[model samples]
Target: MPKLIEMMKPWQWMLYIFFWALFVTSIDRHDLATWPQFFVKFLSRIVQYTLSIIPSLYLIDYLRPIFKRDNPINVSMKILLLFAITSAVSATLVMLVMINTGWLVYERKAFVLNVLFNIVITVGFTLVFMLYFIRRYRELIALKQSFEHKLTAQNDLIKARIAPHFFFNTVNSLVSLIESNPPKAADLLQHVSALFRATFDGAREISFEEEVELCEHYLAIESSRLGDKLVVNWNLPDDDVMYDMVITALTLQSVLEKMLLNVVEMTTETIFIDITIEWHQHRVTITVTVQLPSKTLMIVHDLRRHVNFYIQAERLRAYFDQSADIQSDVTNEQIVTVINYPLYDVSI
Candidate 1:
């Protein structure tokens, strides 16, 4: 009994008390002019109603699981039938008790009328409870579906960040480096291994500095392949701030990887890339500016269509519970991508 009561939600308790109060206050006791008479009649009605409701409440609770497993039509019909039978029995018993105790007039017409009123009130209460349960069930289902969708989006974002294309390109670059510069190739392989290990480390978030270090390793591998052609200029926040702030793992790395792939594939000549990360007012903003040749404008457009920028944007939004304004701006000279999201700490 204690466990069952503990399982009842606050709303359920409130509803029960509300109906009890409604039923008690609704009893017609105006004919009892004296205060003592009114008090006795009211107390009598309260006891009668409370005793009558216990069996109905227990029956309804016992049958709830069965009703929930059936169709809505079946459930509604069963509940109505249960209430009708219980109300008829309870009203008959109450009418008999009232007449025997001289509380109600011993008249056939009056007894029938009282019974009918009781049935109506009981059925109304049952219908309200049923509606509340149904609405609560639907809300629970919607919340579950929403939670599932968020999990799916997070998984997709993580998968996109650690995509096969990046690894394939890194492997091809590693092969080339192995033949030309074995020592550099060894270092690149170690970075690649560490990056893959980090992805499977079961951590959903990492410090800002750790993410930047991962990006630097990625850039190092890319630089080995495109040596003189790739020029990267990094502007990062001060060490005190960078080491404290936390973000979704691989968020910046994913953006950088996409930008690098676009630039490396389109431009053959030397291209400059500037990465700027700033922190202000509890926000982190990463801006990547890539200098592209005039001839590669068409290629950049085609690459943009294939990238999963929207997925990354959604991931950030889910993590921060706010808009992660991820935008790309293209011009005749360069392509700039900006990502802005709320800064969280390790405790979060």
Candidate 2:
């Protein structure tokens, strides 16, 4: 149902009901004042019910097509046509019933008054419906704009994070091998160059599956540096749900990189990062959960504040109108981020 129709005043429904009652009463107003009158009223009511219910059913079925545009002129014309057809059909049924049973009554002034009232009622309902629709339409536009703005902000934030992340990981790799072996440090320098090239090569948006590959590449670089200290787990379906769906340019890559940065900065134990994806009827769910360092939680209080992962979540919501949530337990031993996004259908 259109928002306008759903918000109609009780008086509007009463007006429709009154039209049906008036048709029944008017058709049986004279002549045989007994069973014939009752029969005329009953028969008129039957016609009224048919005309009212069938059109409403058809209208409901075809409502999506009708609400394609929000122009007042077009909407008003459509509403008027619908009401006029229904009113005319009801009037005709009443007139036919009156003539059949020899109870016909016609006063020109009263007939004109009745029609004018019906027009007034129809116009009132149409005006209210349009008012509500226009309000909702404007709201949706504002929402879309707000979302676009957030996406732009998030893109900048991701770009800023990229440079620092790249430098940190590269420096960390070299720093780890500084005193141990000159030959190993030389190899680390090569890995750093390749990692930087891979990380900052392009700013193109990729599909979900592609993002996963990029994430794995980043993790691979980190693993080579961290050795057995880092652990990564993936739980993804074996379908094109990931490959066929588009995500923000390097969105998953940035997130995975961010998680790794936090892990490397804080944790030395076997840090486990789990990534999972699921597809439902209307949405795709992505979950990222990681083990928290023992002392870092005490130092930073809330590590989410330090990394600004919440900003990424807000950015995702702005673009998708889906929900993104992060939760940490009271013990602060783990942090979990879950994102739900509407499935983009590109098959057509």
- Model 2 ranges with Cα > 4 A deviation: 1-124, 167-207, 220-229, 238-254, 265-270, 280-285, 292-308, 320-323, 330-333, 340-348
How high is each candidate's TM-score? 0.54, 0.55
Residue 286 lDDT in candidate 2: 77
For candidate 1, the TM-score is 0.54
Top-TM-score structure, candidate number: 2
> Could you give candidate 2's per-residue lDDT for residues 16-100 as a string of tens digits?
5567556545654554478766666656555564565356535744665655656767756776677666765665566656656
lDDT per residue for candidate 1 within 102-185, as digits (tens), equals: 876778886777667767777787688678767776776786568558857666657665667777889899888889989988
The CA lDDT at 130 in model 2 is: 58
Candidate 1: deviation at residue 150, Å? 3.6
Worst window of 10 by summed lDDT in candidate 2: 322-331
RMSD of each: 12.0, 8.1
